[model samples]
Target: MVTNEQSVAGPAAEQQGFLHQVKSFGRPFWAANVMELIERWAYYGVRAVLSLYIVDAVANGGLEFTHVQKGSIYAAWAMVQSLLPLFTGGYADRYGYKGTVAFSILIKIVGYLLMATQHSYGGFFLGCMLLATGTAVFKPGVQGIIANANLGNKASVAWGIFYAMVNVGGFIGPWAAGYLRMMSWAHVFYANAALVALNFIILLMFKEPERPAFEGKRPSPVTEFVGILFSSVKNVFEPRLAAFLVLFSGYWLMFNQLFDLLPNFIDDWVDTSGTLAWLGKTLGNPTMLQNGLAGGQIQPEWMINIDAGAIVFLMVPIAALFSRMKPIHSIILGILVSTIGIVLSGSTMVGAYCMLGIFIFAIGEMMASPKKLEYLAAIAPKDKMGLYMGYANVPNAIGWGIGSSLGGHMYQTYADKTTLAKAYMADKLHMTPEAIAAIPKNQVMETLAAQLGQTPRQVTEMLFAMHHPEHIWLVFGAIGIASMVGLIAYNAVVTRLPKPATV
Candidate 1:
């Protein structure tokens, strides 16, 4: 049996410089990183604009689904994407990473095409499920490759570099999507499909990492699947790991909002004309000043892109800084910082402040996200690295599914401008529900503005003043604080427990 020290690193590696250690990770590692980059690019490209596409008025090229419907789709998406990995990870280990990856690529391609062609709610939901499933399968295969390739003590550095590559795609995908969607939303989906296909070529460039052989005759597929499911459940329920995952779910609940809810929030309330005008003047580019909105507002994707952009440039150093610290400590610190960022981002309509908050949140993300994977990888048994890594997604699944459902309800109740507008017409104008129903849902705000003898921006400001929509951030931020506190307590308890005996 290979010792933990040997599995992690050779003594000779300790003598090498950091750059040399990085280079030593070799071809398979780099190839996996590239594949990760491409995959993230494809996923985020669609994701960056999905909320808008789902909830925007049909006249404006969106599906015009209610916030509640959008939430249901996202909640289901989280379940399929995050939970399926629990089993797929074992499959990758038992079969081969290469075959799983190839299968996922095809699944993802079909998903993108469905999204592009099918605009109905049921059709689009199916598309998203397919995409999520493909992503679920894809994650463990690539992560397993990384686990096998990083045969050194610089695991933190290796994961950080991999994360930075993830942001490279994250940053670029949204930037491109911001422009592509201007032409047409269909263009964005098609573009992502093409980008995902590039991974097929990347798959050919790397050899599969060696996997452990089964000692006995392999079980039938049905038996093996059941065994994997039972084993995964048992492993997750181990008290220490279970406590950590449950606490970590709160962080993910808050983390996912930056993507799932914030885009709609920005679109409905935040005014970005000032930022757009500033950029256009600063860059001497006229195109930056126009977005078909009344005041030439900055696109929501560009605003949210701040999070990915900050990580792309800063993740490595931040990871290195926290490399020697206990993973739990880093995570606690990150959650605290992130809570502040979330509240700040959501508390106002000022575009610059929103961007600043996103940037701060990115710092917290840099500190926390990679460490979660590193911590899980460290504790996993040598032979079950892929299975354990699959387990790493559990927190995200729980958090995202719950958060999406709750956040959708929250937005619908407390913050939806159209809903508020309809209410305003009912209470203030003494308009009946039937009268309000006569107006197009997309044009409710415009109609409200006309009735009040105000511009759309003026009506939006009035609604903000009367309704206080920004309070939603406080609610989500509180979840992060609770998570941070839970993690701290869990860490204390774990630290007091006895360490396992080294063989």
Candidate 2:
């Protein structure tokens, strides 16, 4: 007789080509994708505006924290979000993905609403903690469902489709949230709650096939998560694996800027009026409901969407192009190319012609990210796939956590002249932003520049200038250069690592 495990898991075989793989997803697949999209939509929307929410002045009805303070809270949230899945994945497998997802969504709704309404910025941060817990519960459970659903030669392609659906959520989240933030900052939170509610409804209609016991054994969630944390820590100390983790750190520190710092950078530096204003014009109505919701910020979350878009537009061809290379080399090349793309994006303040630095960077991201996962999937023991998959996100969590502090310091110590200038401007002018903006640039600079003991051009050209936002570029660019150096050293070490046949 066929074994229970064999029957439940379907047949395993060599890969199917792309078009054939796309045709295989049926009703359940689409349903899962729908839920994925909504989840991402809710999560990313609030995150897109979070930095602004934390740092905006008390007069603007924001929490009014300093940049450093905001970064710490945001980093703490990232740590909890990724760290918990170490346990939650086990619970999800023991329970049901849908049930866990529903419970998490309920908690999130409460958290988001509480955050939106709360007066104390401290309370707002606590509410963020709740939201993070809910996400920690929700995210890995969904990944479990996708893993279990793939049963054959179709598994690899099936997983790829699932990733695309995730990008769909990331895309919708920022696109919708950016618009909402313009009207009421609170609306961003409310809207996330609503989308989450909608996901709960969609999940209710599906029934996942009962999982066959792997000899009817499963560990406690806390035990599994906590064990993995220590285990991953130990594993990171192993010579080869440790080197791998160190190298991987470079990828995430660069990648995470889309979340931690890019949005704030755009708010402080980039000319949103000239470029993004036209973004409003090209879309149907400039003042339409969605557009109105997006607010005035540059929406760096959309930068993440560009990575997703490249998966569709460029990843397939690129993945095939480099299919023959070893995964490690692919990662090294991917990082280098991505750094070039980063330089392109950061080097120029503005340009007369458009070049797709963001698009090119997406190409590099798509090339590396999925490959990294696939590498872990192939190498990790099957019994621990859930735990190992959860571990995969740990580097991301730590990188972004450290990166937030680093990003905050860069923006504050380096790019952040806005906080100081506004004070000096308010003291002298006694006029609002609109009135000051209405005055000729030279007049304000002429009178105030002299008082500050600098010529108008000197103040305009140097530390006081807002229009020339090259300083932020310099900060990110420097990090990218450092990352490239680290990557080069990493590759050198990897070359000395024992080859597959040698092992």
Q: What is the C-alpha local distance difference test score of each model?
A: 0.83, 0.64
371: Cα error in model 2, Å: 2.4
Best-performing candidate as measured by TM-score: 1
Cα deviation in Å at residue 295, candidate 2? 15
Q: Taking the tens digit of each residue's C-alpha lDDT, what string does model 2 give over 1-503?
A: 00000101223335666787777766556677777778877877887778777776555667767778877877888788867776676677778777887888888898899889885768888888899999888875676666666546777666656666666666667778878877888899998898888977778677774554645456666676677668656654646555555557666777766556655654544433335555556665566434434534345555435555555556557867977776666666776766666656654433111125666666667656655655555445567554455566666676678877777766666555454454457765465777655544225555567667886435544543544444555555566566657756766765675544211
- Candidate 1's TM-score reads 0.90
Clash count of each predicted structure: 0, 6
lDDT of 1 at 358: 87
Candidate 1 colliding pairs: none
- Give, for candidate 2, the lowest lDDT window spanning 10 residues: 1-10
Q: For model 1, how does the per-residue alpha-carbon lDDT over 1-503 read when each residue is reduced to its tens digit?
A: 00000112213335668898787787888988899889888888889999999988878777888899999999999899888877787788888888888899999999999988888989999999999999989987887888788466767567656766777877888889999999988898999999999989988998988987768898888898899889888888878778888999999999999999999999999988888777877877777755423387888888988888777677657856986787778888988888898889999898989988988888887777767766776666788776666677798889999999999999999999999999999999999999999998788988999998999999999999999999999999999999999988887777677743210
